[model samples]
Target: MNSLTIALDVMGGDKGPHITINAAILAINKEPRLHLFLCGDKSIITKYLLEHHIREHPQLTIIPTTETVAMDEKPSSALRNKRDSSMRKALDLVEQGKAQACVSAGNTGALFAMAYCVLKTLPGVERPALISALPTHKENKNVFMLDLGANVFCEANILYQFGLMGSVIAEQVDGITKPRVALLNMGEEDIKGSDHIKLAATKLSANKYINYVGFIEGNDIFTNKTDVIVCDGFVGNVALKTCEGVAQLVYRKLDRFLSEHFFARIIGKMLAPALKKLFKSMNPDQYNGASLIGLRGIVVKSHGNASAKAFEAAIFEAIKEVEQQVPEKITIALEQGLIEETHTE
Candidate 1:
């Protein structure tokens, strides 16, 4: 594989540089071909590096910055005033071709704003969307969902574009051929959703490149019925949070039940490994990285409260995206979809 270089916003997340610096070291140790440009305060980053005994590692480069984007910073304020912040500088590296991708666990709005302003959207993409993979019911399978709180609402054409982008990620990143794509809606019936959704469905169905699977309700998200599910940020974000909430609830309830009875406790002990494995597959931390798709350059958003292991997963996600040439593929896919639509007309 070719060597990959990625820029890291070391001081961008809730945990600050400590978590990010540790993740950077973990990534460097795991992937020999990966190099990182750590953008943050020189003193803090250096201290962490020295403690790890990799201050002079060949795969790491420190890009000093004096400013940091706070977790509560307004998107507009960060964009206008944080030109020299770690988040901004990391994005600049991608814009200048110094890095293949940028990864940050920063304020989502601020990251989105800075990345949009710096990298711009790919040609034919009006708005970029957030895409992430969620575990499916089928063992070892996952489905890609998009527009996870990037834009509250979307026009018909924008939603259609999101479906196309999601399809590209599913196909290219997951190696799924002609991945089935669907829209998240209240019901599966053609007449169930708002006008924009129906119109978006029509557009997706017309595009030969996308295997449009019609509408799917939220309950079917993890059923592996479709490879990609598309929706506006508002709906997608709510669905994602609900899934997280339910997962936690189920785990806690199961634990409580097993502890209430001595016999159940014995059974739980015997079933411990299997239950642990099942829960691990459903752990959100393992899927911490969410890709901001439809942009000219690769940008991954790590969970704001991610641990070192979770942040390392985000780094690996960036590496996979870079190796797959996701942005370039999405561009070509959109162009092809447009041509196919024109001919259908």
Candidate 2:
């Protein structure tokens, strides 16, 4: 395969361009066929590159943008006031076909607002949905969930669209032939959940393409029983944050307990490799880079607090989607469904 081009929004993350430059260098070293166009203040990026002794690599290009979207800035204000922002410039590369994908560890609201205006959506999509892979109990696998705080007021039909978008994502990214789709709900029974969720379930069950595996509760998301879980942004965001909080609490307690006792400390040393492996597998950073799925071109949103390793994962994510042609897959699926299935309308 030819080298894939990825645009990096260096100024958006909480850690700023230094971390982005480090991550990009790591990504380029790992993937020989990867080319990066770093968009930010030219001098800062150049200083980092020279300090890291990688000033003139053939795989890197720097696109300077004068403005940056602040972490606390409102999305609408960022859109109206910061037209020349790095986030917007990186997105412009995708729209102009200069790059295959763009990765930003920036403000989610700003990314979505700019992306909606710039690249628009894939055919038949009401709007783009934010989705990320979650590590599951199955070991070495992750569950793809959507609407992680993008559209808080999604309708029954919009939720169904999330199912379709998520279905394509799981299939392409995880190689699931027919991903087991489920609606996030209060109970597993058909009678549970709000009317919107129930309606979406009904829609998914009738759609021949989706696996539609009944309904799954919050506790079931990290299990292998379901492959793709769909929910409105409000509920999905809460469920995601709760899981993250609980995981952090458990890890800290285990670390503190191991540190307090001498015999326990010795045992921990003996089991250090296994424990380290287990914790690495469960770290949320391993699952960074939630794609703003359904965009006309690929756009990935990395967590603002991502470390170098986590941010590199985000770049790899964009590469994977570009290779698998996810946007094309979703577009073809939607176009065919619209033509052959009149019941959809």
Estimated TM-score per prediction? 0.96, 0.95
Write candidate 1's Cα lDDT for 1-345 as tens digits. 438999999997889888999999999888899999999999999999989876588898999998999999999999999999999999999999999999999999999999999999999999999988888989889999989988889999999999999999999998999999999999999999999999999999988878999999999999999999999999988888888777778878988999999999999898889876676556553356889999989999998988898899999999999999999999999999899989987
lDDT of 2 by residue, 53-135 (tens): 87698889999999999999999999998888889999999999999999999998999999988999987998889888787
What lDDT score belongs to each candidate, Candidate 1 first? Answer: 0.91, 0.86
Worst 10 residues of 1 by lDDT: 279-288
Over 4 Å off, model 2: 270-287, 339-345
Where does candidate 2 clash, by residue pair? Answer: none
